[model samples]
Target: MGTCACLRVRGGIRLSRVQHNKGERSTLMKKYLATACALCMGLGVAQASQITVINSEAASFVGVNSNESLGDPSNVVMNWTFTGGFNANNVHISGNLTEVLTGTFASEADIFATLPSGTLDIDQSSTGNYTGTVAVSTDVSIATPVDPAGNVSFEFYESFNDGAGTDQIWDDITIEFQEIGIQNGMVNLGALPSDGSLVTYSGHNVAGGLDFFDFSIGGPGVGAAGSYLNAQTIDPVTGDTIDTEIGLFDSAGVLVAFDDDGQDFALGGLYSMLSFGVDDPLTGSDTTPGADGATLAAGDYTLVVGGYDTNFEDLTIGVSTLADVIAGTSAGDYDLQLSYVPEPASLMLLGFVGMLGLRRRR
Candidate 1:
């Protein structure tokens, strides 16, 4: 009888231990499943928040130099068919023109005296119709002295010398979204690892009217609209400072923000510096505190760098504080560093992930 009772007790203990082990395994599986579901949910939220460019289009504005004293500006109509419904708020339009000297000029002075200038005015309709008027001014400078033999190639920015007797003929014109991003035609800076990554790139504003660079902001910085960017121009060869101006455009090719001198005092020089999505409270200040600036939505963006006052020609060559480089002028080896910002949404996701990890530990 005693032997039988001992046998029964041993069997009961073994059965109890087996049941406890199975219960532990079930609890572990439940916890793992909960964590996995949370991760997937977070990822879904992130993916839904992303905004991307679904369609793009291009058009050319051709100029004809009639036998008249001044050439005529060409009006080009641009059309876009969006596979996905068009977002008027997100639509951006930008263009660039290459100067092709059809015939030789008489003299160098005559080159500037009769320098060709063109205007590309973008008019957008509520129905997504885009009309551009490219009018070349009449050559009033024809009376100016000329050699009629000398020819020169000059680099000028867009919208230079609007009212003067300068006429422009734009060939190979292209209009589209931020198609000028790094891979398309802008300078490439490689992959950006994180926020505050100081990436340096160099390029020249020569025959190409503008220099554009593409950079990405990922991780926790993907959705923060309050992030700001800082760009400063440095001489690549001598490291001597060069006056640089920077503009930020969204993937849609819209000019979101611009800055001329945002970092003068900190660098203690006149080299160009600009901030995007960041506010500059200090009047006449060159540096903008990243915290107090304009807000930029997280996504791909194009950075356009040019000589100071090299963008538009409202100011004169010598009168305005604009850079001296004008049409037919080329600046090379300009260096700049881009400061990045993280998105606010990324931070929230990170926090949620951390919480999941803690729960799993418990």
Candidate 2:
């Protein structure tokens, strides 16, 4: 009978031990759940804040050039359609520099907004890849000569390039233009801007944040006898410089490639490509800060093309106008690769729960 009583007492002690172990396991499980929630929350925030690059459409008033108005095959238009992608598909940007007369403020002003209306949009399919297109209509206009008995003529030359930046590399540079078509309204005007006449030329100047510039025009402003200059007037007419500057469509009627040391576009100079120094907001300087050079990341950007990194004193406007757009149009998109690395808290909770499981099994 005593042995039976001792066995019962021992069984009660074992039962108490098991119950105590179960309580500890429950506490460990709660901790494990909390840790998991925290980890998931952090991951969610990280993913939500990721950055992306997109394509866009934009325009600017770079400068101007004048040509004697000529008939088709000589007097020409260059409607541009820019298309391309970056390595690893990080940036997707494109647009058409077409001859559209929709002169809204943002549309006319040298601004880069978003895609469709803003210039570009990023590929949201995946944070790493992007793609899009822009259509720019480029047409030259031949003004009726002041001399009723005279004709007008003009021609265009365009080019493209990838601007400067660290994480950005532009490749597969393909510039496509629509082949001139014969319409019913086509005129065979000849011997343009007959001597003793005045023609007016105007257009926009565009550039990427990477110090790259592209020039375009609509009206063949000047006849062969005249000249033009794409310039920047910092003080506006006073022609002085301060923190503020603006582009000028110099159809001043001078045929020289440059004036007062002003830069000039070569013959067939529609797509004038050049690099310029971007003023550094941080240091208030034009030179880049690092060897790779200070670069623009994925954000809104206003890029100008005038002067050089080492030659600021000259103040030569590289192209006619400056074009601004989003950094995504150049940088592509932002994506961070992540892996599941067990956290210390998670490990501790798992360990405790595992131990409880073992205890329950026992």
Candidate 3:
């Protein structure tokens, strides 16, 4: 979580749009893309690569975080999948990030909503393990690996440290599950926890936060329509911070989203992963707080990363300030990691360039 926040955005956003074809831009789209692509090339503006799930299985906690445990993969195993006689599985969180990056949103409406779109059904296979079906739709515009969409089997685990005596932080988990074809008879599939490539970055967090600045989905005018940032603080050395959370603040400096532990889907859910989708409400309003799940508008927002002693839920929509959240945590090194999609607008500019070149050659 802290290592990702260590990343720095390149300057402010600068984009140009022609006004003449607000309605007829489709007709002039080719000319614009061709011209824009040439300009971008002349200016040496390189395109940012988007994510393509490279491996069928996510690199193990060791695959990415080999820096800890002296590069001995055996030390950091996924044995923490269970805790205290319960299933501490957080495979659903892996599903969540995968959905967001693929431009999909999963909604779990409160029972009180006027026309509730979601159903409250869990397969709690065992009263003790707490198993249930999560939302994964190949049925919708975006097709998840699952066939019928809502037939995902997820077991919510109260994430806890692996007890290996290695203090560690988890970050940016792109959780994935195996597809078992049909739905009706729900089957338990294994998890392909694709914890995103965990490359460490230096120089993160100002005092207690991993701060950065940038635009939202549609560039300047839009907020981060369906964006999110997930953070978890982990280290092998006990002296280093173990539990680190994150907060997203808009330009207004309000604490929009704050997470202490992640969905607790992985690593005992001790890390934090927060969503900044436009549909999601501000934290403190939902003030339910912490690893439970929180949302904020995705845009040019500030990120606060720090360590705390225990789970604190004081970060309310109207009441919690930046200091209020970070003040509670112990002073520790913030390890940050972030996973982001490409700027669509930039992709458009470059994408057209490829098509045009192919046409010219033909």
Candidate 4:
């Protein structure tokens, strides 16, 4: 390791230490935000993540989910870097898998049934520190009635059917998921706007399944007073879109809000929309009616955008949505839009102006 006195962005900016004129305080809030947002652009918006080497019978690679919310069907590169040396020379190491298993999770300790998986048997008489990686999406999701909150829910255990040699002394084996930081399960979408503007996140089910994003209600740009969000499935080239569904979850990972056939569109209700403080009860969660006007408060929430038929549920029907998509039911590219809609006051003002205009014309 080496050390140098380089410009340091130690965590974040300390405004108190760099004091400006007291008179500039009024403009400081807005100005500081402008500068801060710019800094955020450079610092990045991924969640904090940490990886620990496991000695489970499951000797496969374990990765940190960091900024990825549950249901995101993106391929993650799992890297394994070992610091300890193995005992042997002229040692060659290689491994492969029998097959691949995948799953999306809302929690840990999945109750859904899965085919039995065996451990990857790796036997190597290698020389120095070793590093390896495997591109795996997911294995299975652990859920409620199984694991507690904040516990990472899924693991990728690719079994190696080669030799049986576990003599690698691995004290620090690091595995990374997209090089993103992992916080206490909070996802920070890179494109989410911090300046209170309409921001849209475009996603494709590259794997053609369900996708998810986690954010906070009263956190930063999204104030605790609540939020407005919508999702639309698109066939960009064709211009003809399909039905899209959305589900909302609280910090506890409970399915508190879900919408099917929501979102007022000129074409129809093929899109999805939810307003925490504005939208009527009927316009919000079909599974949880109380979710309407319920997003006001400082807390975390996760949004799930899935195929037209995918719901917030378990696999009573087989790997649940995963299998359904394979059978060709729910899967596609979609857009999730988050922004603050017009408030009641603004609407009333516009209505008042309209009435005044009519009277003048008469």
Q: Where's the lowest-lDDT run of ten residues in candidate 4?
A: 106-115
Candidate 3 lDDT by residue in tens digits, 8-88: 332111122324457766645444344333333333422111212222222122222211222233433232221122111
Give the runs in model 4 whose Cα sits over 4 Å from its true position: 1-187, 190-196, 206-208, 219-242, 267-269, 279-291, 313-328, 341-362
Residue 307 alpha-carbon offset, candidate 1, angstroms: 1.8
What does candidate 1's lDDT look like per residue over 30-125, in tens digits?
Answer: 543443333233223111001233444333334422111222233222232323222212223223222223221211111111112222222221
Alpha-carbon TM-score of each model against the true structure: 0.37, 0.14, 0.32, 0.36
Candidate RMSDs in order: 23.3, 32.2, 25.1, 18.3
Rank the candidate models, highest TM-score first: 1, 4, 3, 2
Write candidate 2's Cα lDDT for 250-292 as tens digits.
Answer: 2331111211111112211111211111221111122121211
Quote model 3's TM-score: 0.32
lDDT of each: 0.39, 0.21, 0.31, 0.37
Evaluate residue 184 in candidate 1 and report its C-alpha lDDT on the 0 to 100 scale. Answer: 15
Clashes of 1: 25
Q: lDDT of candidate 1? A: 0.39
When 2 and 3 are scored with lDDT, the better candidate is: 3
